[model samples]
Target: MLNTQWRVLFVFIVLLIASALIANHLTGRVFNYHDPIGSVRAIYEDIKTKIEMAEESELTAIKTIAAPSLSAKTAMQKHLPQADTTRCVDVSLGKVKYKRNGNIYTWTDSNGVPHFSDEKPDFEAATLDTDFVEPLDYFELTLHAANLPPSFTEELRIKLNTVFKVYGQIIGVDALKKVRLNLTVFATRRSYEQAIKLRGADPTNTDGMYFHSTNSALINYRNEQSAMRTAVHEAVHAVNKAILGSTPRWLNEGLAEYFEYTKNSMQLVSVEPHPGWVNNKRVAQSVFTINWLIGLDDTWQTGDDTKLYASSWAAIYFMMDSNKGKQFLKSIMLAEQKSPCSKLTAAELKNMLYQHFPQLDKDYRQWLKTPFRKQSF
Candidate 1:
């Protein structure tokens, strides 16, 4: 009986130890069974992992939702008629008529000088040539304006005509006979920002924008200093899109920057120094190379906005400043006409530049180093 009890006790002890070890092994997979604090830390880490995955999923969903809007914009841009420089001049249509704003009477005096006023001027009825003038057909302008001088819009119209004539002469092409343009001149800056937001564009650090979706240019008269320059800058974009058809971003913005500081007097176009590029020469040499500039798709893409503008403006300045450069410009534009919808590769464009001016890379840098006196095209 004593020997039987001893065996039973030994067996019971052995079984209890085995059971305890089994429980510890199962709990060890997650955490130490003896450590409550370790279990709490493990639970926290698991929750953190789950939360991180959820956040990643949410970000992915947001991106997916935003992608279609970008695609739609691309499609709309593609839908536009992409005309080349060669045929841009040849598509001259009928002249546009002035759709005058409220109480706006426009007429030329006996001396053939044009005039416009909100208050009716004391002029003979026969001198009223409002019905006959057709300059508006070339530049279709819609003005959402108030409390502005009647002369403001009229003067703007005349200036835009000068722009057409001068750029036409520069490129050796006739100006398009019709271009539909919308200019919204808000009375206050608040109204302008609100308008930009409504169009789904950021209004920070900008006074104006040419919205592709709306096919309109927006500006405000609150800061009158940069208003006209901004207007002409954005207008050039609209005209380029209509005439040149998807001009390369470097060239497009370069041209806009070139013309923004224009002195259009007596039907002549003269370009002044660009504010973004002119004074920042040393920085430009360090930041830009001809090959790099040509490769850039847009300043926004690289987040190199200022240097990009500076480089582009410098490039255009160098091109228009010299006879060979003008020849090069003409050659580029002519070559681009052949492939309107297709953009030339960086290597292809670089090769073309070298073909025209074998030392263009060196020449461009030299021009930027020296202070340019005049860049008139």
Candidate 2:
């Protein structure tokens, strides 16, 4: 009876040892049991909370940074009043019938009738003839009679600052120094059309002009937004004049178009190649058709006038499309500065361009092939 009792006690002790080993293995502990699950859950919750807090802090920082940079109100006040002016010229078709204000000349028509208007009959359409007189003294900001809305002048000024900032960054210099702009806002289509006629008649004649100066610009205010776009385009012209001085016509128009289409955040969003004589197809056609007659050197000077502006803009766009294009443009500007205006013919300019940038032609051709994608401002 004693031996049987001892055997039962031994078996009971073995069973207890087996149970302890199984528990240790399941808990991943060889010698002791530990509840690691609770600690891991606690760490995970702590990390998740910290991540969310960091995101909130980042948003607060952005707001703080953005608060002080807005100047829409102040910019408007300074620029709106400065842009008002009227541009008119007196012209005589025949002998003077009466002369009022030594600047104004009146004449009689061939039919023995007296007529009076602001401009002379002999003056060509779209041209400013010195023979025609302008009574107003030149001001920095000149607007045609009743052209712009009171609210838009300030907005236009702010946009101008933005354009200059971006342009200066791209060109690596202060472009405003070399260029000055005169903004002309015309209220009615008649005034706008009249201004266009005056300017168009003598495209090459620069006397008694509104925007005839290379360093200066003139714009029509179709609306506040159109006025802004016009400002951007003209501002770029000012920048180009400052940075590159006198550029090839193709390049000049191209760079202007580039800025016209590419400078605004809105423009980049919906960029389509301009069509017709003013843009893409006409420009490309000019290159192919005129390459033989004018050659690449003089192509810019006397190609299809319509395409010249468009193609030039395309070329500028191509150059600004990538980092390489930016660097190449910088080099071109440097080369231009070194070359004297009188000595720099188209051929010499082209040679210099090739010398500095072997890939320019190739890259330009490639840019012509690439599809355009519009961007929002």
Q: What is candidate 1's CA lDDT for residue 315?
A: 76
Q: Residues 247-292, candidate 1, lDDT per residue (tens digit)?
A: 6777777777777776656745567776544554333234467678
lDDT of 1: 0.62
Lowest summed lDDT window (length 10), candidate 2: 75-84
For all predictions, the C-alpha RMSD in Å is 16.5, 25.4
Note the Cα lDDT for every prediction shown.
Answer: 0.62, 0.45
Q: After superposition, how far is residue 157 of candidate 2 from its true place, in Å?
A: 3.3
For 1-377, candidate 2 gives per-residue lDDT tens digits of 99999999898667555545543544333432253344344444555676788997898788657655423322111110111122221111111122234333356667987655556567532322234322121113333425556655555554554444444445543222323455565665456557656654332211112343323454544456556555655555554444445455455555544544433353333334543223333334434321221145354322333344445555655556666656656666655544414224556555655665576656566656656544222
